[model samples]
Every structure is written in structure tokens, then in C-alpha cells.
Target: MNQGLIPSRYAKALFEYASEHDCDKLVFERMQALSEAFASEPSLVKAVRNPYVSRRDKIQLLTTASGSTEGDSAMTRFMELLADNNRLDMARDIALAYLKIYRREHNICLVTVTSAAPMAEAEEKRLKQLIQRHLGSATMEYNHLINPDLIGGFQVSIDNEKLDASVANELKQLRLKLLN
Candidate 1:
């Protein structure tokens, strides 16, 4: 389902709070960790959403996922608030929204490349250079990923714009055309 404005609103509120105390950077780091954890582990979402799990347990899980120290008040308080409101299930979405907000605030573009297999260092360097030529001085954060299901080829995304050249995608399009 579409997240709508709820996650964005939560993210903004958190960002504002962090900003008031010059802790936005810290919060961004925490959110980044949380977002990465959610991406790497699908089951974390389920655990957060599970009604049987106690709020304390969920908070502990979130703290651990953030890789924070013994107790970070901001992170701890935020988790508590989420748990209290039963909004923990939306934590990942909130974290992702916050990331976009942070990147925009910092004038950083997030570039991600996903391929069937890991690209060679030289190939990756050339790809990044190609991207830099197009971006023209925009500060960028690069992320590389492997999705074997792509079958072959690569996909590059600069912020919201995407170039898909995956064999799997081509096959899917061909299948649709043949069926029609």
C-alpha cells in the first residue's frame, strides 16, 4: 500500500526535533542503520508488526537494529513513542522517508546500481564516471547491489530516475507483447 503522508509527517517531526538540538545528523545515522537493517532482514518487519511481542521487546529489537550504544535517549525515546502508538510496523517506512529528507537537506543525491552480479572494479568506476558526467557536480552517495534474478545486465537509478537494462525485464516486456 502507498505510505501516503503519514510516514513523511512522522519523519518531519523527528527531523525537526533532532534539528532543535543539532542532532539531526545523529538521528540520520540512526535512521540509516534502521533502514539498512530492515532492508537486509524482511523478518524484522514481521517481528515489529507481530501483536504478541511486547513493546519493550520491540524497542530492544529496534535499538539493536540501530547498532546504538547502551542507551541513546533520542533513539530510545523515538522507539518508545512508536511502540506506544503501535506505529512500530511503519518504522522502516519512516526511516526511509527520513533518509530522503536528510539527503535533500544535505544536497546529496543517492545513486544506486543493481545488477545480476557484482560489477568489476573498473566497470564500476566507468559506470560512476558516466553518472558523474550526467550529474554535473551534484554530491552523490553510491550504493551497489546484486540481484541475481535480473538474469543479466544492470539497472542504474539516480535518485528517482531509473534506467533498466536487465535481461529479466526485457523478457517480461516481450512476454507481455506476445500475450497481447
Candidate 2:
């Protein structure tokens, strides 16, 4: 299930193209829209993957799905290239890879917090502050996940690092220790 080589290659090419053309932001926006549409509409992906669908039709559908008719030429050409190669299925992964580069270039960090229930507003604010302190000058975006299986407590994830304090995780660790 892991995406390797292809997505990153395409994403790097697209990123370089955008950077060269001074349209990285525009391309990023288009890719964001494309990724969101792929997530929200299952049929869109099917259409892109369907062999019966014409290339022009696929491009048109993808453009429409992006929710913008007047998309940047670079992005439009990128979409065409993906369709021509019959690799439209990799669009989402490419977009995600592009986003990672964009975030790194923009000094933005995505943080995820998972807990048994929704966090209170005060707790959320405090958590943001704490993350901000750790991140220094970089900006932080918080995505909260509610997982009842956590039982209680929360976990915070930043890039490759994760701090797990969830009750379920703790219990599992304790069980392993006792078993040993």
C-alpha cells in the first residue's frame, strides 16, 4: 500500500516546474482542490481510472472536479500529463507529496491530536500554544481526531514524532510488561 518512487518523482517534477514558472502557490492551490475533490467524490476517481473514458473527457472531468474552470496553465498541463500517462490514480499521492514540499518551504507544520472525545476550547488553545512553543518560528496547524477506543487521554503527532498518552495504548504497554 505504500506509494514509492512514482508519486515522488511526479511530484518533484511538478514542484520544480511550478517553482521555475513562479506559480508554486497557484499549482499548490489547484492540487489542494484536486485532492479534496478526490476525497469527497468517489466516482471522480473511477472515471479517471476507467479505460473507456476518453483522455479529453478525463481532463474535463478532473478540471470540473477541481471546482475551477480557469485553472493555471501549468496545473492544467500537469493534469493532462497525468491523464496521458494513465496515472491519474496517482494524482492524490502526488498532490500530497507536493503539499509536503510546500509546507516545508513555507515553514508550516501539520500537527494531529487524537483523544477519546472532543477537546474543550481552553484545552485546545493551550495545546496550540504548547505546540507553537516547541515549533519555534514555524507555523502549526492542528487536526483533532476523536477515537473512543482511546478510552481516555490523548496523543499528539508531529511529522515523524508521536507522543502517545492514550489510555488504550498505555494499557496495551502495561499488559505487555506484565506478560513478560
Q: What is the C-alpha lDDT of each candidate?
A: 0.90, 0.85
Model 1 residue pairs with clashes: none
Q: Distance from true position, residue 61, model 2, in Å? A: 2.6
Residue-pair clashes per candidate: 0, 0
TM-score (C-alpha) between model 2 and the true structure? 0.87
Off by over 4 Å in 2: 1-3
Candidate 2 C-alpha lDDT tens digits along 1-180: 356678988989998999999999877777788888888888887887788988888888877666555646786788889987877878778888898888888888989999999999999899889988999999886789999999999999998789999999999999999999
For each candidate in turn, the TM-score is: 0.81, 0.87
In candidate 1, what residue range of length 10 has the lowest lDDT sum?
1-10
